[model samples]
Target: MNWDDMRVFLATARAESLTAARGTLRLDPATIARRITRLEEAAGAALFLKSPQGYRLTEAGLRLLAHAEEAETALSRGIGALSGSAEQLGGTIRIGAPDGCATYLLPQVCARIAEAHPDLDLQILALPRIVNLSRREADLAITVSRPKTDRLHGERLSDYKLSLAASRAFLAAHGVPKSVSDLKDMRMIGYIPDMIFDAELDYLSALGVTRVPLASTSVSVQLQMARAGGGLAVVHDFALPTAPELTRVLPGDVALTRTFWLTTHAGPKDARLDRITGLLRDGIRDEIARLEAMPVARNP
Candidate 1:
């Protein structure tokens, strides 16, 4: 099998588009097509289902993804070792995160890392749902809770603060609640109960909120809803600085705290990955501390 075909296959699978893969690989359209065909022939199965939309991986292709990723990792390590840059951080590292951390923190944290390591490629998969590390969805993931399975390894990053918040307009329109019990009577903005992917994310339930008239699975979206004066939301303290339109509501009475856990597959160790992960730990921790330190406004 041609090793170049594997590279083409991986790129195509990631983008799910021939044109998109061509840009990444810096190759012509015809070359990319020929390579995919060759790879499919070698694998003895149709790797992708072609459509006017884009390439969707077949079941065989999905099964082959794990092996392809392993091969890519191995080649990256081999190339680094041969070039005598094994100790230096280089190569792509995809980090999956819940949108709250991803939206407010990762941009700056990843920018600084990417700036420091000019050769590195960093991708952040910010989703409303939990990132599946076992399927290699991301090389690393920042989760609210630690890995529940032994197949993965986790390191605690830091504990961050959260508190109820609403737009100043919202407070003015619907009277600020003097107590936690008063919250139930007001408009509440929070994650959709059924879509709460993690236990740590079900903040509203712990606060005794059973009905969220305004709800979304995305932290960023919920923040926007609260900012628009829709309702009160349990906004991340670190994220408050980014949305100045929103102000804390009963900080002392309705405060919540959560931990960030960095998780990875519990498999072969790579010094390159280890070095970069150390940088990720420091970057995220410092960012959380910096953002959380910024003063948030409160209703008078």
Candidate 2:
């Protein structure tokens, strides 16, 4: 019934671990357990089913979550309205970002934020599983595709170009392809099912093709596989220079490209969110320019 209790449930449901929920909420374990227990008691039903894997929402829990989220949204609006004039950005900012930002962009931005605003807590939760902002799982997000929902306010921050790359050793072993038609003969490492390009089926389709032999999978795994000289992979240019072993194959003419969007809930304009988003936008702008400067081998 209490807002705090519902928040605890929502966090637990998203994290599927009481310990993780506690960390996100910055609360102690006992307090979180007690809150959830009290909420469950009040609801007269079990919200979660605990098993070895993790917390799974019960049917009652799922039903309650729908209503709880609406309540939270209403609560957020009211809080934003009341505190609209607050002068400082002192609260925690929860962000859901892809692995790229987690690896490339976050450290510098986080360090800057820490030095500039010691009072503001930054929580960067890198979920390969994208969090739904509408549910308040995150206050802000950086994603490749902007949400097509009225509930979100977003902007395309930068356009990212990706190229197929391979380690010299792998290329020497498997031999580089001279044309898109040659890809069928080559062993290719690619992102797993949920990856941006993997989901779109556009990365290859743009080449006027479909389906490549899958040698290895997962974004994290594909990077390693390609690095180990296992096979060719499509990766963002920012990832290329950092990965010393990988060499770009198909040039700018054939590379895959997509835009990154900075998005937030369509709530009252938040100064804190705007501040962080602005910094990120500026930082990535420099990165994109640097990427554009790199030498690209144009396909014949």
Q: For all the candidates, what are their Cα RMSDs to the real structure?
A: 4.5, 4.9
Please estimate how well model 1 matches the true structure, expressed as its whole-model Cα lDDT: 0.87
Task: Give each model a TM-score.
Answer: 0.76, 0.71
TM-score of 1: 0.76
List lDDT for all candidates, in order: 0.87, 0.72
The lDDT leader among the candidates is 1
Error of 1 at 151 (Å): 1.4
- Per-residue CA lDDT of model 1 for 1-300, tens digit only, reads 767788788888887889978876899878998988988888899999999899989999998877887787677666646433544467788999999999999999999988888888999999988897754578889999988898789899989999999999989989999998888899999989998899998888888878899999898999999888899999999999989899999988988889999998776546677677789899999999999999988877
As a TM-score, model 2 comes out at 0.71
C-alpha lDDT of residue 93 in model 1:
87
Q: Where does model 1 exceed 4 Å of error?
A: 1-88
Instruction: Please report, as a residue range, the 10-residue window in candidate 2 with the lowest summed lDDT.
Output: 193-202
Q: Per-residue lDDT of 1-300 in model 2, one digit per residue for the tens?
A: 877777899888888887778777899867887888898899999999987688889999999987876787777655555443465446677878777766666666677767877777888877665667865677888777777888788788888777888888887777778877777677776654345432432465455434555533345566778788777777777766667788888664566778878888765554456666777678777766775576644322
